[model samples]
Target: MGGGADDADCGDAENKLGCILSYNSHVELCVVNYTMLAVSLVAAGGLLEAERRLDPSRFGRKFVWQAAAFMAVAAFQITLCFVVNCSGVSIIWNAVVAFNSITVPGDTPRHFLFMYLLAFAMALSLDVYYAFTLELLTTIAHLCSLLLGGLGGFMYLRAFPNYGRQLRRPLLGAWNGDGGGGADDDEDDGSTNSSTGSV
Candidate 1:
């Protein structure tokens, strides 16, 4: 009797597993995943919109620029996975880090962004390992946001020259000229020309 009961329990477990595998059940998990994914995507979109309205000069400040790139990386990965069923999130994340290392040196915001990406990627790996539907989907979405945000930030930075420095150059030249009596020469020449014409 005990053996028969054990066999029945095993059979029930197998049936439940089959139902989950078929995707006809576990509606709650699916709903949660879908909801989180939608929210993540929408949030990224909002950031992109706000980024467009901001002045390009702001990106040169370091933190804001790198943060934008980070967001872009997250967005790209998530969108790729969601739309194209990508499974290479790790590869893309590493590539971003590598790009940063190669292109930007010193203790910069990109390093900080690297740390952040590393942490998020680890969390995503754990979610996948445990077969967590909502958690996995959320991680993917977050990744996409980071990816896309970084790209948007980079684009914004590229849209303008170093406006702050460019603006300063002319001002600095004018100040130097004034200090050297360059303005006085112009006035003196003008006065001499007027006197000659009058005579």
Candidate 2:
């Protein structure tokens, strides 16, 4: 097994190291994309259910509309990911297909759809961010990463204004088993009533 041809076939260890790194990166990126898709779908479904159960006095028409919009955007991203995966083209060509698929739209503005695309694109760049050094390009690229992530986060929070409250209330209730948040809610209600009465 040890000969000139075997030595050439095995090649240098450094070359093998690069291949190993590239293979691991692609595997990790696929894992991240699948995770993003799963979480997006869960968030979209939860928001839709919350909208359905919302009280008009607490959540007005505007609130409902925003919830719907957020849900739609999440669903749209999930759909695009599936489309790209099913197309079986290389990443570059799949991106072209995704662009055409999203832009030929109906009601929603093209620019807003681009924001959804930007969020996914930023997610995909996570691997590149890890691989690159801290230079000007990397700095600018990471800034774009944060901006897109923030935009998507803000939209989700806007759609679910009481999300934190609701999420924490359950944990609080479970921990104390007496609904610990009720007193704080009562105080808030009392303050609101008094302020409204004065008005």
| RMSD of candidates 1 onward, in order | 17.4, 15.1
lDDT of each: 0.38, 0.37
TM-scores, in order shown?
0.26, 0.32
lDDT of 2: 0.37
Per-model tally of clashing residue pairs: 28, 0
TM-score, candidate 1, is 0.26
Candidate 2, residue 177: Cα displacement in angstroms equals 7.9
Candidate 2 residue-wise lDDT, 1-199, digit = tens: 0011122222333444332223223444345444544443443333334433432355565445545544554444334324322211122212222322222112212333344445446444543554353234333433443444445545555655654333333322333443223445645756886989942
lDDT of 1 at 17: 34
lDDT of 1 at 144: 53
